[model samples]
Target: MPDLLVGLVVLVGAVVQGAAGYGMNLVAVPLVALIDPRFLPVPLLLIASAHGLLALVREYGDTDWSGVGWAMLGRVPGTALGVLAVATLAERPFSVVVGAAVLACVVLSVLSWRPRPTRGPLLVAGVASGAFSTAASIGGPPIALLYQHSPGPTIRATLAATFGLGTLLSLAGLGVGGQVHLTHFVFAAWLLPFLLAGFLLSGPARRFLDGGRMRVAVLTISGASALALLVRAAVG
Candidate 1:
């Protein structure tokens, strides 16, 4: 029953990802961690990996491969470093850091103030996304910010490819860390159908949602999620 509940959450997570071009891990990881921390990060990575691929397929012709390629250059190394750091940190501290960083990004977005220097920002965004995603399964902000300035279709396509690479890097790093196990793989597999269903349902919404409105929504939800994590950390 718990796994079933998680599958449902993954479905919702997938819808968010499909509509917003990011948020699979943002929504899934913290929630799943409530059920099982050991299982949360790796399985969420796998699920995101699946969604990334599906997204890439859906937006194949629209991608800006140059952006994705440059992002991956930073993401691959950053993911490795983040996995190492996470392996050494206590769970609570790690969660707090991840949540805080995500929240900060959200606040900045809501204010309509973004990082400058568009061309160079992608590398930094890639590194941040890869690191956070690997460490805490909440790497959406960095890449999402990068995509926010792009045309809608291109934004979606580039994010799909970029996140796909990050997930691949994460899989390799987690396997080396001894965090990837049979149970995680099984859980991810079980959640796949539901996730796909949610993504399908969200496609129309994504098309119709105005970019400005979506940004506000993303910022609001991300801020709220971050605040909840901080409160949870304080209590625990």
Candidate 2:
């Protein structure tokens, strides 16, 4: 891809990541996929690793470390399993399964079907999110569900920390598998300026969002992406 186009993608992605702790994948992967779909998993993980570290720093003192730790317990094994799945599975089938799961969340939400408000349910969601995120780099839906029970900053902090660790694992795995290259790191390095700028702009916006409204918006975006994936999967 041309440098200008790549810059454009990075810019948009940075903004999305700025506004939401998790948009690096949501914003960049689709556009990058259009250019070279197989590159999706690698760049998404790298960009996510960058944003994850940024979030950890910005939200440091305010983070709920206990929650982050608990989520990681499930995430570690979940991610390992997810990465294995990605290694073994075909892209189209995997995308379809994830798409369908996301669509189910959308449908349930629209119908006013509340997520089961039990600890067991939340744990299950956490595990699912970890696995899917590790595999597809699109793990926001499960996290979105979990965050509905939290305030905005807490939600952002927890997600940033959890995804930060997950993305770290992903990058390491990709490196071991020879899926990521120095060129990709260079690309990501060049894009860091926009990522920082986005985070700066997002700080104030994030502070102003009503806690309840932010939770709802996060779920809605996740749901919309799932719907798009469903269409892509079905048609393709």
Candidate 3:
């Protein structure tokens, strides 16, 4: 029953991410944190990596390789910083920070702050993504914000490539810190089918998100999910 609930969450998160380019973590993190904090960080990262891989396979040709390169450069250091923080601080505080970060990005985008996926912004977003993704398993918002104005395919493909590589780096960092365990992979395996289901569901959702609807969905889903994280953190 618990796994069923978690699977459902992963399913929905995948669909959101599949259509809007990002939101899997935003939707999955807080609720999973409530269900089993132990399943977090590692399991979600694994699941997210899979989701990114699926998106990449679907839209491999549309990625912004130059932006991905810059983002990766920043992700190296940002991931290290995140590893250090996760090693030292409690997870709840990081959750609050990620929640706030998502909300802040959403607000800026909503207010017509158009950030392009150029070198400077990609680097900055990559850093934020690495740190947040490593610490809270919710790194998509920073990178997603920059690509929010892009065509749906570009947003999906680029973020997918970036996230797939970035997540591997984070997992390696956590492994070195002795935070990752064999069991986490098993837990992620349990959620894998539902994650795939969500991605499949997202195929049709992409149509629904066309004609600038993807941008609105991105902002709305990200903002609402951030609020949920904030509330969950505040209550506990």
Candidate 4:
């Protein structure tokens, strides 16, 4: 039952991410954690990595390598910090912190305070993304906000590239920290089919979600999911 629930959550998250360029972790991490905390960080990172690879292939030409490089540079230190946090913090407190940060980012983005994707801002976003991603497996809003004004394809492709690489980095850090075990891979294998299904469905959904109004929907979904994470953490 837990596996089925986790699969369903990933399926939906994949579709959201596929269409919006980012959101799978925002949508899936909190929900999956609710079902089974063991499915976090590593397994979800693996699934998200696969989804990001597909997005990068589909929109390869649109990727901005310079921007990706800037973000990755920041990710290095941020990833180290995140690993330290995950090792130190308790589960519920970690969830609370991550949820609060995500909600704050969503609110800032919704207020039309987008920062241009310049070198400094991109680096900052990358660092924040890396920290949050490694700690909570919810890293997308920081980079997504920086590129909110970009073309849909560019946003999707660049984010895909960033996340694909970032997730791998996080996974490595987790492995070294002893946060990843063989069971995480087993769970990821079980959920792979659903993740692929969501990715496939995203192709059709993207046509409708690639418009200006889609930003509103994306923010709404992000905010709601963040709130859900907060509520769950508080109740627990």
Candidate 5:
């Protein structure tokens, strides 16, 4: 039943990501914490990495390699900071951190902020992405916000390229920190099919979501879930 619930969550997240460019982990992390906080950071990272690969395949030609490179350069230290976070924090506290990060992303998304995909901005986004992604598996907002003003294909493709590689770096850092374990893979394996299904559904959903209509709804739901997660963590 837990597996089924998580699969459903991943499916919804993947579909949102497919249509919207960057929302899989943002949607998945907080709700998944409600079901089980331990199924985070690594397991969701694995699923997100897979989703990014699928996104890359469809939009590879549109990828901005220059932007991806700049982001990756900042990701190294960001990942290190993430590793340190995981090594020091306990389960409930870590869950609170994840919830807080998600809340912050939701707040940022609604702001009148319109950051561009310039090199300096991309570097800063990359660093933020790495730290958030490594720490909480919620890395999409920083980079996605930067590329939000770009063309749809460019947004999807560029973010995919950056996240695909960045997720790997995060995994490696977690592994070195002794946080990666066989159990994480076991959980990720359970969500594989749903992730694919969500991507498939994206072709149809993108038309509806492209006009920026869904952004408010998505952010609202994400914020609520994040708040719930924070409450749950605090209570526990």
Candidate 6:
């Protein structure tokens, strides 16, 4: 039953991410963590990597690889820091911190504060994304904020490409830290079908979600999910 619930959550998250360019971790990680704590960080990172690859292919022409390279450079050190956090911090405390950070990002994005995607900002965003994503499996907000004002296809494609590479680094960090196991891969495999289903469903809805109103809605949903994680951490 828990697995089923997590799968459904992942399906919904995948659809949102496919259309919006980001939000899968924000939407699904909190709910799925409640269902099964073990199905986090590493497992979700694996699934996200796959989802990102598919999204990138669908919007291949829109990808901005130059920016992605700088982000990857920043991610290397950030990922190392995240692995250290995962090894040291208690789960509840880490969740609370991650939730707070994500909420803060959403608020900033909501205020129409569009930071230019210069090399410095992209690198900074990448560092933050790598740390948060490696620790909590929720890394999209930082990168999403950077590209929020761009065209929908560019946002989706660029983010997909960045996440594809970033997640690989995250997975490697988890593996070296002994946080990943064979079961994580098995669980991710089980959820792949649902993820693919949601991706397919997003094809027709992509245009609809690309509107300004829909972008606001997506940010709201992401904020709400982050709040949920914070509340859960507090209560637990």
lDDT tens readout by residue for model 3, 194-217: 998899999888988876687887
Instruction: List, residue by residue over 103-187, the lDDT tens digit for candidate 6.
Output: 8878877776666678999999889888877776667777777776778888889889999999887677667768888999999
Ranking by lDDT: 3, 4, 6, 5, 1, 2
Stretches of model 5 off by over 4 angstroms after superposition: 85-113, 211-236
Worst 10 residues of 5 by lDDT: 213-222
Which residues of candidate 6, in runs, are more than 4 Å off?
Answer: 88-98
Q: Is candidate 3 or candidate 6 better by TM-score?
A: 3
User: Candidate 3 — which residues are off by over 4 angstroms?
Assistant: 87-98
Q: What is the C-alpha lDDT of each candidate?
A: 0.75, 0.69, 0.84, 0.83, 0.78, 0.82
Better of 2 and 5 by lDDT: 5
RMSD of candidate 5 to true structure, Å:
3.5
Distance from true position, residue 124, model 3, in Å? 1.0
- The residue-by-residue lDDT of candidate 4 on 48-84, one tens digit each, is 8889999999999999999999999999998887878
Report the number of clashing residue pairs per model: 0, 0, 0, 0, 0, 0
lDDT of 1 at 142: 72
Residue lDDT tens for model 1, 122-222? 78877877777666556667767656655556766788888888777767866886878898888778888988998898788787755456655456556
How many Å off is the CA of 103 in candidate 5? 7.4
Clashing pairs in 5: none
lDDT of 5 by residue, 43-132 (tens): 888888898999999978999999999989888887777767867877578768767876786677677655677889888777877776
On the 0 to 100 scale, the lDDT of residue 102 in model 6 is 74
* Runs in model 1 lying further than 4 Å from the true structure: 36-39, 88-98, 112-117, 210-212
**TM-score of every candidate:** 0.86, 0.85, 0.89, 0.88, 0.80, 0.88
What is candidate 2's TM-score against the reference? Answer: 0.85
User: What TM-score does structure 5 among the candidates reach?
Assistant: 0.80
Clash pairs for candidate 2: none
